[model samples]
Target: MVDGAGSIGGELSPVLEVGKSLAAPIWRQFMYLYNYSTNFKRLEKEVKKLKNTRDEVQHKVIAAQRNVEEIKQNVKDWLTDVEKTITEAEQLIQEKANNPQCFKRLCINYKQNKKAFKLKREGIDPLLQKEKEFDQVSFPTIPQDIWLRSSEDYLAFESRTSMVKNVWDALNDENVYMIGVYGMAGLGKTTLVQEAGRKAEKDNLFEDIVFVEVTQNLDIEKVQTKIVEKLSIKFSNETERANKLYERLRSGKKILLILDNIWEDIDLKTIVIPSKMDRGGCKLMFTTRNLDILEKMGSTNNFQLGVLEEEESWNLFRKMAGDVIQTHELNSLPNDVCKECGGLPIIISTIAKALKNKSHPSDWKVALRELRAPSPTKFMGFLEKEYMKMAFKL
Candidate 1:
């Protein structure tokens, strides 16, 4: 009889343990439900307030007079998280009110409710802080006199002047955004663009004009640094530099970004120029020696810079060569020397400067002969072709 009673007790022990486990969860659920019921009104009030705050933020984001695209996106993500938490809390409240019998279900609902409350508490402060930041943020002002101009005189011939004028007109046109100026090296592409920038500044066509030189061996960091310096914005962290640049430039202001000397196709976004030009009224004007690069950049207008005409080339040479060519005997010699330069302004300017101080006609003759020699690679190919032509003609 004692063994039978002991076996019966052992059999009941498992059942008792299960009952104990179930009782604890039941009690915990009861307490959790009581507390939740007591706080439900307050929680509802807080969530309502949070929702109203979110709505206000949304309205401010939409109605604000400045560009807040980055901040707005951040706010959007935060609100989405908050909304998910709110939905979870609502579902947990509904489950608890139904008095679920499963211990596991109650335990899960309780933990989830606690987590929801914690999330709401943790999220609200940052949301409010960001709201304050948004309130205080002042939109960026338009940049002025940001165009970099050379100290030397920009001589614009008839054709070159027409090109410059066309560029200026395109830059101002609301429809025309990107302008490309392409030509052989040393046809005065840089000088012509510089002149256009100066005129645009004087006319106030854009709020800001940023000039950066993107060379053949592109250094992205250097380009970003130059733009940062022009914008006068301080930042740390090289990894985030591109993002910072985008934020600064994305503000709603008409910006003219002049990228000089683009050799190949470069992703503008990598250099912090927004891939899409829709940010504010931002426009891009780049100079390249190849037309294909302009096409790659999606240029809306292209201007090919031609070499100076024979008469124009002589005039530029005489101006650069100064008083040496004014002598009666050297007059015809200067014209002959300018002819050999093949109307390339760089060669004409360089040779004219070399002959500036020399007075003798013999020196002029010697320089003309040197100009006709096969030039090194750095010299214009057109000059080489011209030399070959003259040699064949002779």
Candidate 2:
């Protein structure tokens, strides 16, 4: 009797183990039906929290941009992950409208409902933690300035490419004190210099770079502030700002200064800009529409950029305007328009983009008329082109 009882007890234990294992999957199957609405509500609430975090971070991003600081990679990564998580969770919510409940059909998909539960723990929670861990949104470094990023690489011609190389080589030349890139307006002077400056910094040619565009209305204080700011220094009163800038440059760091769009000369005495004689590691580069201005600045190496060749101009224009201008009806008119731009990249591109929408021959004639009818604000300010960029889209 005892032996028979032991045998029955052993069989009962395995049967209980089997029953316990089956109960879990059965509960899991019903969980979506029972908790589907609850999980969705929780996920929605979590997403809202995530969005609030994103909003706060976005403000930081804007401030970083305004201050000309680089946004931290981790912060950028977290933001991307948050956006993806919210999108997936929201998609799951939208899918629930036609989805069969977990208990309604034997073969029903629980993936969508399960994601709602999984996302809170898997996606939203991690982002919330990441947000809490962030102490700052940006890091400070001398980044390549505007033109390097915003302008397209049009170093197609060997001439422009050689100019860029010569300029970079000039910076390395020990005897070279101040370098100037001289050309008429819209000749990509700013673009070329900025790219060279970027390469110099990347190759560790310069310890730091400060780039500031000194527009027509030059504010001495504003110029000083911009230079100081790029070096991660605060500009207080004018005297204090100049002193700080001068001292920083005098610190013997190989700092490259690029002053763009200088209409007239700025006094180094007032700004306390140290020369290479004082600090051999420091260098100055400027761009001006007039070669005379470069000469006045005492540029040791003045490089002049020529207008793009006829072929280059058409290629640039076509790239912007597309085949609409290349159609059968508009063959010579396109060439005529390219000639009107006079090999200036800015003019060619702006005219092409503005004319891209206006495929009619009459529209081309109107553009030609505007090009021929000279406006005082046409070249230097690009006022006409600026207007075209906005007007055409309307």
Candidate 3:
């Protein structure tokens, strides 16, 4: 509950003031959230566009492949035809030589046509060489990007732009950057990272993008098989699963792995991080709330997520409320109301939604009073603690 009118206002203003000073480029802070939203919408539009493009490319490549196959078959048939022709020609020449008088007129004509025989041999040799090269060539399959949900309307996340971009750039770098993106519950860390993975895949930054949610109870074998399934590689024997995974991961291609909801420090050796990949760079991105777990994971860097700005928070609250509070009189109290929610987007949105049906000033005051209750952070912390417990069990 938010105490909108009393001591809660005192607490809200100072936190907002301190947060603004602690974070630079205040508006720039929201870049990741805004860019993610924009990119997601663009991707949605391009998905259909790319589908048509892939269909067209597939049709063209298939036609080209078939033509190459047909050429090889034609050469095979021609070779058979030529073999019969050569055998018949040899027999004719032998018979003509043996019976010179019988072949007197024909012998002169056969000698005169030797130039045509040379031309036939020359044409067949080049065609055969071409057929061999065509047989060796294989066309590549068109790549497809996976579709994940967009985060454009997720107003609570509008201020996490820098941290998101840092993670994105780090993942896109040439080294395996193990970066951690952590936040209190419902700050949209998983959603933002997933969207980043989708974007990376679409941009061709990686050959493969994998998403795995690691729960508290760890199963090493299960994780291995899941990765194999995602890559569409087969395992002849379950015993060789780890070996096969190691081999596949080492085969020189950039892979972006998203290990979401990670609570425990994962041993890279057991996961087979493929230290010897022929590919220059690959990445692993993890999301968690526990700082100690991240440190144990040997993170190259860590990002701590904070609450949204007042303006952004209010905007998100308004959007969630929709047409219920259209006029200035109703809207004027939101900043005072929002501040009491401790700048947490989840809390703000939840409260805004609960009061969407109420239009009177007295009702708004009652709602604010509830928010100002002593257990505000604890209320939000309850969900985070449960989720964190579940995430780290692995």
Candidate 4:
């Protein structure tokens, strides 16, 4: 740059001095070509390595896709197999439930091919391992004597030996005695049947006695479960519940089945009620406020459980009010209370117990007067208005 900017006095011209640079384009171009070639080769090598890695990854991805498909197919196949086994199990159970002999045969068959059946039935896919935890098998428990509004009716029936014997014979009869006990609420229809259950058990009339409550909210599955549980059948899944119940029940063992508190009409065929062969000498008993339910259950003989007769009413009342009688000074009040109880044991018993601690006739009179008033559990009005209506109509 200093040489190019020469002094004006004695220096060379600036334009002439600046034009003296070396012209070496040919050498620079050659060097550039050589470096480009090296860089191109290096890029080619890196591209080749990337291609190799991509090929490996693609192969792995293809193999993984195939494996996933294979797993899916295996699961589907296993599910198909399981469903088939469940269908067969259910059919077998239905057969056995209908006939006690089939139950015995199924037990034998199950023992023979337990492994094959399990694999065919449920354990085909390991993914469904948790499904085994879900249970359809419930063994029946010895139900406590928790009589709901039916105990008193049964108690009254116990006093009638002829009626008791009639019921007993009908239950023991071979032609599947379907006895219906019909009444209104608090009239003791349930009580009568429970009393019959106690008697049946006491008399050793059957190999087993089972009670199934068909509540107002009736589910056939629940009824089926109750029967199965009572019978103590071992079932592992929903598909097996019905079959297992049938197989366990088909032994031709004389059994008494109590169907209690039936609210609606249920189809016997749908519910798997035993026919002549499957019945195994089973007797079916039903109690309901709905006579329609009784008719549907095929009650050959229906017993209309009425309010306690006057004497029976007094018997129940005196039993409950003995404490009241002892404590109260006026003896006339006991008769007054009984007269007002109106021949309903439950109402009389409940009121008598309520009045047991009170001291005065005024309290007794008030209780009696209240019962006569428009209120729930109006003991006297129930006989004249409610019980008679239910007895004749229901």
Highest lDDT model number: 2
Candidate 2 local lDDT, 89-152, one digit each (tens) = 8888778766745553544456776888889988999889978889999986565555445446
**Candidate 3 per-residue lDDT over residues 253-350, each given as its tens digit:** 77777778876888877876664244335567788878788888777678887777878777878876666666455666666776776666666666
User: How many steric clashes does model 3 contain?
Assistant: 13
lDDT of each: 0.69, 0.75, 0.59, 0.59
lDDT of 1 by residue, 225-297 (tens): 9888887767778767667778767776888888888889778777777755545677888888999998987
Better of 1 and 3 by lDDT: 1
Q: Using lDDT as the measure, what is the rank order of every candidate, best first? A: 2, 1, 3, 4
Q: In model 2, what is the error at residue 58, expressed in angstroms?
A: 16
lDDT value for model 2: 0.75
Task: Tell me the alpha-carbon RMSD of every candidate.
Answer: 20.1, 11.9, 32.3, 27.9
Show the lowest summed lDDT stretch of 10 residues, model 1: 1-10
Per-residue error (Å), model 1, residue 148: 4.2
- Model 1's TM-score against the true structure: 0.57
Global local distance difference test of model 1: 0.69
- Candidate 4, TM-score vs. the true structure? 0.53
